[model samples]
Target: MADVHKVVFYPVGNGDTTQIVLSGGRRVLFDFCHRERAEDTDTPEIDLKSRFKDELKAVDRDYFDVVAFTHADLDHIQGSTDFFELQHAKKYQGEGRIKIRELWVPAAMLLEEADKDHQQEEFVLLRQEARHRLLEGKDILVFSKPKALADWLEPRLNERGEAASARDHLFIDAGTIVPGFSLASDGVEFFCHSPFIKHCDEGDIIRNRASLVFNVRFLADGAYYDYLEVGDATWEEMEDIVRTTRYHKNDDRLAWDLYNIPHHCSYLVLNEEGQKGDKETEPKPLVKELLLQGKRDAYIVSCSKPIPDIKESYEQVQPPHIQARNTYERYLKEVGGRKFLVTMEEPNANKPEPIVFEIASGGVTWKRSASIGAPAIITSTPPRAG
Candidate 1:
């Protein structure tokens, strides 16, 4: 039998939650967003807690191999504190909570400060948990080692009678492959693309600018594929990634077979200075180059609400912008891409389902919706060699 790997994007309505199920049955989850109301059963969004638990039970597991929080944004970390068993606090542990064998966080998540009003929020709590894991020097990968983070962490290490550089191996930087999984052994490898040290060194830490981005490369039967998991980075940051990556002569990291579009299809991701006009927003030069790197039969997925073409939606200030959607669709066509999918609008907006893709020797194919009543269908796109 052929090796089959699965990638799933859950419908969380203007949020992000994706899972990568490797052929070996190990699972890696990215940026969970479980709306509290989704548990009602009548809501359009999936009941993330119940669904994830059920999936784990079927496999006789209660932990994810790795759970990466791209950033501390509310949309990405919503209800995450309640879903996972946090090691930092006894109050958050137990209660049948799922465990995270490894936690991945950007350095900014460790250095950012919250005001008194926001101190008790989930982001703050998650930050505490990340700090605890890093201090323990195991079961965590903190991306980027900036001066600010080092300055803050060194003192704590000294207080604990450990060397200042004790946790250096725990830090991952841009333009490098993550340590754990390798394509040769695990059929997958992750290349860090954003959250550079400079991103943290330059004044205050902007969550979106400092969020995590990775080029996830998957191998199957001598064929290699790339999936880009981008956080809510803006056009300036994307341009920086493109420029820096090219300067390092690691341009292959920019190419992608599947792209998780950033910031819920916000126009800022296309043009740094905001929308160009009413009709469509042209991507900045480097952003355009990044989009054009999509391979044949590529896919761009937006984890946002349904983007209607009506006048009200066109003039809206917030995301799920029609103009940005138009820009993405135009460039997707230029690359001979397969589809531009919106999580909330797939198979009708009223009852959206998780969008899934299966990767094997046949390359990548979009499978049917995971929702009940949807056809058990799969696209017949031919495989392409890496």
Candidate 2:
């Protein structure tokens, strides 16, 4: 058995972000979310300045190895802006801020073709800083289409400013692997999976399909540990990856120890169903198939509210954004293997703090810093919620 590795999934705003601490003691951040919610309700407040400083303090000196932005959604990219500001203002009351060793983003994210307004300016700044660091000979790995997309997006940004090509961003194809840490060194490796070449159409939906999905793997205790974070990608995107990669059904290569369910376990990402209603009569077979294939040890959904009911009015649904909760509960039971973790179940006044899992010779064990009281099920439909 090898030493242990720790992964922390932080409960940020209404989204998902996790921190990966390797056995070698290197720290990596998967995604960072917005500081506030849309309705301006009181959730746990994330003090960016203090939190950033605290994150550095928690780890060893200047030891944050990598910061990965899964995609360009506001919730994910907003923190980078705050991070850049904090990093730039080196002197914090005469102390030094943590030095970022490297920044890894998808190649498509750095594209010049995107309309400036469509993409956040902070992302542009972060990309620029990374480029500057690279010019100074710092290691920057642009996984999946870094070269090709950088070639396309950089010039466009330079010519039109960040907002000009906001909507015209570059997209990376699925199944591209970005080589990084090896299990031998207790490092992390990403197996790229989605957003094959950008343009996917499902009507009025945000370009979440453009998200770069990846399976992060590392070895611990002589056993392989796999964590799959498939950003808010939809059914179309998932199908695309499976088909394009020729990912064999039930292949162990696709198996995972943990999975962050796409779009917070919304049925839209699993079935043809959208906000209109669930089209699935029985469980979506693919949902079960993926679970079986992945051999998921656990599932995590980062959502603000319970899954919306298909029968209710769009307004009545807590989030009204995605489909009913019953769909997931039903599907989970059918798939049956791992435990399910949802952020909304936390009892804390603030959003539940991150959930940390340690992987060691004995297997994985998790603990929570925040007081998430108990798990409760709030269905989207009336009969279930009450």
Please give the RMSD to the true structure for each candidate, in Å: 1.8, 8.1
Displacement of the residue 32 alpha carbon in candidate 2, Å: 1.0
lDDT of 2: 0.55
- In the predicted model 1, the residue pairs found to clash are none
How far residue 216's Cα lies from its native spot in candidate 1, in Å, is 0.5
lDDT of 1 by residue, 1-386 (tens): 57777888889999999999999888999999999889888888889888889788878999999999999999999999999999998999999999999999999999888899988899999999999999999999999999998998999999999999899999998999999999877899999998999888999899999999999999988889999999999999999999999999999999998999999999999996655568889899999999999998888999999998899988888898999998999999999888899998877788887888888887878886564223547754554644
Q: How do the residues 1-386 of candidate 2 rate in per-residue lDDT, one tens digit apiece?
A: 45767776655545656777777777777677656442244556444435545666655455467777777676677655644423323432124544456666655455533476744476566656555543333456554443455455456566655553342322223564464567666546767776554442322224476676777776765666677777777777766665655554424446666667766555566666533354332334554455555443444444444333444434342332444344554455555434556555444534545565666654455555532222323221111000
Residue 22 in model 2: shift from native, Å? 1.2
| Residue-pair clash count for candidate 1 | 0
- Tell me the lDDT of candidate 1: 0.90
lDDT of residue 191 for candidate 2: 71
Report residue 179 deviation for candidate 2 (angstroms): 2.3
Q: Which stretches of candidate 1 lie over 4 Å from their true place?
A: 369-376, 379-386
